[model samples]
Target chain A: MDEIIRINHITKEFRVPDRHEGLRGSIRDLFSRSYHTVHAVDDISISIAQGEIVGYLGPNGAGKSTTIKMMAGVLEPTSGEILVNGCVPYKNRTRNAQNIGVVFGQRSQLWWALPLVESFRLLKDIYQITDAQYDEMLALYRSLVDIEPLLHKPVRQMSLGQRTLSDILAAFLHDPKIVFLDEPTIGLDVSMKAKIRTLIHELNRRKNTTVILTTHDMGDVDALCRRIVIIDKGKMLYDNDIEHLKKFFGAYRTLKLRVKGDLSEQAKRIAAELPECSVSANENWISVLVNEDKQKVISVLSQLQKSYDIRDMQLEEISSEDVIKRIYEGGVV
Target chain B: MKRKGFRFYLRIYFKILAQDLKSKMSYRADFIISTVGMIFTNIAGFVSFWIMFRNFPSISGYSYHEMLFLYGFSLLSVTPTQCMLDNNWNLRQQVYSGDFIKYCFRPINLFFYYESEIFDAKGLGQLAFGIGTLVYAWAKLGLAVTPLAVLKLLVFLAGASFVMAALQTAAAASCFWIENSFYVLDLAFRFRDYAKYPITIFSPVFRFIFTYIIPIAFIAYYPGMMVLRPSEVSLLSWLSPLIGAVFFYLAYRFWMYGASKFNSTGS
Candidate 1:
């Protein structure tokens, strides 16, 4: 794939005033000055290719937003370089902005009291879209996002989901080559989230728009992105295919078994025999942790059946949350 | 594309301004009351001057009507920049809220974006009243309608607006380091209050300061002085607007420097 964004050893640091907490401390803080330097985005390097939907995964204060801000031309890196579409974003903001679209989920860019249509008209003027192009793009967005019902509604009157959808549409109205979405489905309901995800997939497939999405939801990653980049403490910890991420960190599955009678002795024996598995028994239910290579759950059940009647058996795939927790706790990847 | 640039920015500006007005109009009573209140406040300011002038025959060799011409012109000249560009006045909030991020990615100039957000109907109303007051003062004073005087006034007004706008922009840009710019803006306002009256009333040192350093005299006193007393139209009078323009350019440079600092600091 052709490279669409090339971020080379980008670093961003901030100097925040060091202030004491109390009233007395505050008065002293006015006269006595101190500052603490925070490295919001360290010397990090990553590149995204054309038609790529990269999932940028991180917890809060993990520099995901800062990185995005730099790429979006909202922030300048303290040192190092970032070139989006062969243009340094902060240095050539107008040209960079023409080729890029950015959406911040927490803020609505639409005019608050104006109808969605009016905002679109203003955007067309701001972006200098031709009349025909504006019409075609608006029609396309209306159909894709089903924004017909929302066209006449004032932005402040629209629901969060509606507003978010409109914001996404507004971002794409310029037909930008790259779109940066920060928490695009942050506060949406399950159905709205699915709709947004589907819309994003469709947009990518049809337009081949390069997308960089920063989201907290793992489902957003699983459903949309084939690649994932994870960062923590202003450093990139993982940057590769999603499957590789899962393979490296997303190991271990759970086996939950329900038996008919009290089988504490049998459970203990099984726990002792299967040293690789973690066995937990509560009341009539027993849960066993199994490695990825061990899939003969039937054999374990058969052995358990010799001592106690098996009432119900179920197997569950290890969730991504558990994988992340294990990664954090074990420092595995 | 070059020809279209100004029209493009102006179109977007008016569209945004219209939206702001509509939003304000949603509170119909508040809009009306505020507009009326602004007119009353301006009238009160002029009334206080009238009362003061009644006791004193003249101030610094200028009569009441002549001073009103200066005051009215200064108020009118700065109104558009103040009312339209006042959004830049909230640089403190913009910094704290990280709202400047929005401007960085826009395909327009940051100055235009900063000015557009605060375009309110109340401001438009004030601007209209200011212009009206200027015309009334001109007619009452029987100021000359010579082409040269009109040309000078227009240049002076444009230059004054640019300087005022740039100063506010510089103050707002201070948010990069200070995080709160309102105090700086407040101080700038106090400094600007000296321009409300004639610079002739001040000492030679102060006159020099207003003319060369802060340069508020270019907005009203200098141009008005040149027009009302054509005998004083030296080369300096014609060059005063250039000083304002230079100050405006410097202020713009200061704003760009602050923005770079902000970008480096990140959100």
Candidate 2:
């Protein structure tokens, strides 16, 4: 599929007032004006194909939201161009809005005091969605999240999880060609996050939806995004797939072993034997970190298995957070 | 495409209206208290004027009953504008709270979006009180309610409401640039109080500022003058609505200009 969203050298500048401290200065500020220019989104360019779930990751204050707002047509860039589905989002805001679905975390488009279904119906009317299309979309989302029980409940009365679920469903109700999910799982519990991830995955696969997901949670990136884009200080740091990132950092693996008998003695012996490896243990759980180049994971497990019965073991992929942190600290280890 | 566009916006407008009403109704105490407070405010204004007229039979070539009609006309004109433009007053807070961002994604005019955000239940109370005052004053004055007179009243009120709505909306839009527009809106709405009284009561400079610079005096005062006074000089009051329309257009243009500079403040 062709590129559904293309951001070309876009920059957003904000002229913020530099206010002085103290009550006297605040009163003086009422009469005088002083401003400092802030480059909220520096020159950044990106392109995404249809049905691609691109994880737009960044630390806070890195212009991730500025870029998303520009894409979502809620903001205008100071310079350069942005094309979403061949329409300049700022110049053709209403037209671009017709083709885009935007959810800014838990902040919702649903009417707060109305029932969830009432909000959906209002959206249906505003978007001019047909009855058949509305029913199909509602049925499909209901299957994913089971929103039927919550449909009669007012949005203001819902739990955070239920509200976020309803918000995600409302974002896709019109079935826009492209969707922007801004920190969709921010305050959600683990299970709620999993449900949201599943919804995104299913929606993208079934509807060929082009998704741009901005998230701070590494697990969300690991689960839902194949291609990752890391941005910091309003600059693009890296744009590559998970495989490419793992290629450099994935060599080091952590093995979490549950020894049924004598956990600390085995943990001590392993730490003493493998001086290079880091070992930490609880009452029954032993965490053994090993680099494949120095000492293979299989050998470490074999060595541990001889004395201690490995009741259960877990092999963890290097977390996306550590990978990004490593990249930030020492440039793509 | 034209019909579709019109119908689309109209549907969205009512949908937002419905939601606003529901949200207001949910806060039962706030809703009930605000409505009752508005009714009392109009009553106090009427009683204050009644006391003033009771002491002095006339002021500046206007009788007690004529002054009541003038104030009632102003109230009718101002109350609906206050109701319709409630969103404009709240625009500063909306921008601060990031609710303004959602409005940009709608397939509707930005001004239309602001219009839809407004649905004040308190305005119903004000409306009831205003009509009651206007009828009482009209009956006391013993003026005939001719078809032409009724039509004139509506046209002038529409013009007055437009002027008030446009100014308040423009003041709110200024919040996008100024960040806080409490003073600007306060000044705009407070300045409008001059229209409730006769322009002749103020100094020549005040008359010029209100009549020419702001043109609010034309909104209710001059129009009310035409209805109640009806002298040869009162013929000039017939031009109030047209003058109001021009000022309203200018205010809308100012609002759009301010909106173009919006920075979307923060997260």
What does candidate 1's lDDT look like per residue over B1-267, in tens digits?
A: 233477777787778888878778888998889889887877787788789989998897888777777777778667766687677667778668876666677777876676677775566665776677777877887877889778877877777776666666676677777855678877766676677688878999998988777777777776666666778666666676776678778887888778767766655
lDDT of 2 at B78: 79
- Clash pairs detected, candidate 1: none
Error of 2 at B122 (Å): 1.5
- TM-score of A-chain in each prediction? 0.83, 0.80
Retained true contacts (fraction), each candidate:
0.68, 0.43
Query: How many residue pairs clash per model?
Result: 0, 0
DockQ of each: 0.45, 0.41
Best by lDDT: 2
